[model samples]
Target chain A: MALREDQILRYSRQILLREVGGRGQQKLLDAPVTVDGASDVLDVAAAYLAASGTPLFDRTTHGGFLAGTSLESFAPDAVAVTPAKGWLGSFATAPTIDVSLFRLAVSNGGLIGVPGGMPWPGELEGQGSSDSVTLGALAALVVQRFVLGLESSLVKVRNVDGRWQRE
Target chain B: MPHAVIDITSQVCPMTWVRVKLKLESLDTGDTLEVLLKGDEPLRNLPRNAADDGHVVKSLDTLGDGTSKLVLEVRHG
Candidate 1:
């Protein structure tokens, strides 16, 4: 989706952060995100997360399954089952305790598409130790670059003996 | 670090990765290239392709608005 002007302004806040600044923002505006899944929900959720700050999520079963399942199900189940109130108790407690569980369950059979997964410290660290706002600005800059058409130029070169020549 | 920045926005598919490969070849080992691009296809594909070509993707970040960027460190083959 195309970004609006207000988004640019709002995201400018992220750009202003020392870690991001204009250069980092430009870098973000130019980055790419790959979403692999059958459903668009994961894609949307990913979009939301990317906008929020952290980016990168495998929309596949393996990746999403862990986020949607383990976090949404197992964690909650372990907590609910501690009281031994049975399946009904687990169900009753599930919605109240963690809204993400209910949201994931109602949205799909499994937690195929839920937002706010584990933050990728590696990627964030790459952006430097900026605050969430700065990170968000960096993300905004990335989106801007994406819309602006900032891509590498490819020119094929042929090899003559050992040296290379552009084709 | 003497990083080279390539703005490959609007470009698509093989072209995006191809240009990146070309730029890396011009640099010596341990050089860094900051590639900027758009589109989901390239965002997902280029990093893997870079790795296959022996470049290390130091980081890949996507803006909330849908744009993306990748920082690749070049290692001589």
Candidate 2:
């Protein structure tokens, strides 16, 4: 599909990057990225990724505490974020592209703090009032992680000749 | 069989469907794609959309809190 005008403008910043030039941009538009998570988490990520010109397949449903469970269900080629439980027993396997995790707690009336350990940026201490904004921020953070390569973490366990090796 | 998984937590409409469609296209004929969605709009629309697109919806499991996981098997000839 040809790039739309708004798409070109919205993703201009990304397109300008050496790694994500016109070809990359085209790939993004053509390729689909699936997301599974809580409605708020997936919505935010999908909106940002889509607006930024990446075709998205958002599979976020209404319940479930962690988004990773949702991702595990869809089984996309790559996942941006997953729930905590999904990370278990699969630490050694990394997505071909990237995966992200957005963490948030509903407190006072705002989302705050983007902890370094989590993929989603920290909530803003008390910024949970507007769920939409919170979702948007989380989505933006996921995108940032994707761009910065912060989302891709390869957990390695040493094995010598198929045997466990001590570090 | 090739399987694709997506995590769509904390997200809302349009985006949910958009992501699903993209994943569907990536699969080869006879492959299956599963989607975990957690919103009302998406829960209502994703399966319908997938069916409309000619994919076979294998299953849709709904949880108590209103979240759902949909399994779609690509059926391109």
Point out where model 2 deviates above 4 Å. A1-167
Candidate 2 per-residue C-alpha lDDT over B1-77 given as tens digits, one digit per residue, 9 for 90 to 100: 33888877565666566556656666787888878889788888888877876789899998667678788898653
True contacts kept of 2: 0.00
CA lDDT for candidate 1: 0.46
**lDDT winner:** 2
Q: After superposition, how far is residue A98 of candidate 1 from its true place, in Å?
A: 75
What TM-score would each prediction reach against the true structure?
Answer: 0.31, 0.34
- lDDT accuracy of residue B17 in candidate 1: 62
True contacts kept of each: 0.00, 0.00
Instruction: Give the per-residue Cα lDDT of candidate 1 at A132.
Output: 32
- What does candidate 2's lDDT look like per residue over A103-153, in tens digits? 333322233334244533224325443555554555455454454444433
Lowest summed lDDT over 10 consecutive residues: which window, candidate 1 chain A?
A94-103
For model 1, how does the per-residue alpha-carbon lDDT over A1-167 read when each residue is reduced to its tens digit? 22234433435555434344334444443332333442333333334334533233343443221243322332332121121123222332321111132224324422211122322324544555433322233333333333334432222323345332333
